[model samples]
Target: MQQTFFDLEVALASLPRILEGLWLNIQVLVAASIGVLLFALVLATLRALRGPA
Candidate 1:
């Protein structure tokens, strides 16, 4: 019973670290997505300006 309680406590304490890692992963993914979107937009704009060669 005592070991179970200790295990539960450790699991709860680790939750925040896990959440923080997940948040960081999400942030990095969002940043990469934004960068790709911007890059594509710029490429499209340049293509439009070139105008049907």
Candidate 2:
């Protein structure tokens, strides 16, 4: 008998769950990106004002 480190059967069985997690991660990434962009825009706007920020 031999043991293997990789199993295609097990991976295929969990594909749906894996894809669900991937989607969740993508959502978080997009949200974070928007938040960062908004923050940068605010900073840039303040800098344009030419006063203490």
Candidate 3:
């Protein structure tokens, strides 16, 4: 059966306003992952250098 706009609105309204919040969270996580990967590369380079000269 076909649904109506009111049905859609009601379904959406039933959930928390976390859809936008989740989008932001996913964006932050992706950025953090990139940063962590870059930082890990830097750390590996430092480790290759052995003790401080």
Candidate 4:
């Protein structure tokens, strides 16, 4: 009897699910990046305004 660390069968069976989850993560990342960029733009604009502060 022998034990192995890598199992191709198990990995192949789960690949589809893993890819689906990865796609979902990518969508979330893009949305978050856009949100951060918008927030930073607003903050920078406020800082650039001429006022006493």
Candidate 5:
């Protein structure tokens, strides 16, 4: 069988690189989320403390 639009061999060859990119994206997403949460927490703490300390 032959296909023009999709090729299994080519796709299979590219799988590892694709997986690496996906993992990199996931790491970036998690780091960004943590940074955002920390920033928000800092702001909220400041707002709550207001001039108390």
Candidate 6:
């Protein structure tokens, strides 16, 4: 039980670093998703307008 408490303490100390990395990854993923969606929307619009021309 004593060793478990020590391990828990170590894990808690490292939690912030782990969460920081995860937050960074999440931000990157969100940005990439938005970029892809915008590109896709533009392509779709262009494709729709192609038949009339």
lDDT of 5: 0.92
Candidate 5 local lDDT, 1-53, one digit each (tens): 76735778888988999999999999999999999999999999988885845
Global local distance difference test of model 2: 0.91
* Model 4 per-residue lDDT tens digits across residues 1-53: 75545878877988999999999999999999999999999999999999975
Q: How many angstroms is residue 41 displaced in model 5 relative to the true structure, after the best TM-score fit?
A: 0.4
Worst ten-residue run, lDDT, model 2? Answer: 1-10
Model 1's C-alpha root-mean-square deviation from the true structure amounts to 3.6
- Best candidate, lDDT: 4
Native-vs-model 4 lDDT? 0.93
| Ten contiguous residues with the weakest lDDT in model 1 | 1-10
**Candidate 3: where is the Cα deviation over 4 Å?**
1-11, 14-16, 50-53
TM-score versus the correct structure, for each prediction: 0.69, 0.79, 0.60, 0.79, 0.83, 0.74
Residue-level lDDT tens digits of model 2 in 1-53:
75545778877988999999999999999999999999999999987887655
lDDT of 3 by residue, 1-53 (tens): 77666696777885566687888899999999999999999999998986967
* CA lDDT of every candidate: 0.91, 0.91, 0.86, 0.93, 0.92, 0.91
lDDT comparison, 5 vs 6, better candidate: 5
Number of colliding residue pairs in model 5: 0
Candidate 6 per-residue lDDT, tens place, 1-53, comes to 45755587889999999999999999999999999999999999998884744
Off by over 4 Å in 6: 1-6, 51-53
Per-residue lDDT over 1-53 for candidate 1, one digit per residue giving the tens place of the 0 to 100 score = 35655687898989999999999999999999999999999999997895655
The superposed Cα distance between candidate 4 and the true structure at residue 47, in angstroms, equals 0.6
State the TM-score for model 5.
Answer: 0.83
The 10 consecutive residues of candidate 6 with the worst lDDT sum are 1-10
Model 1: lDDT of residue 18? 97
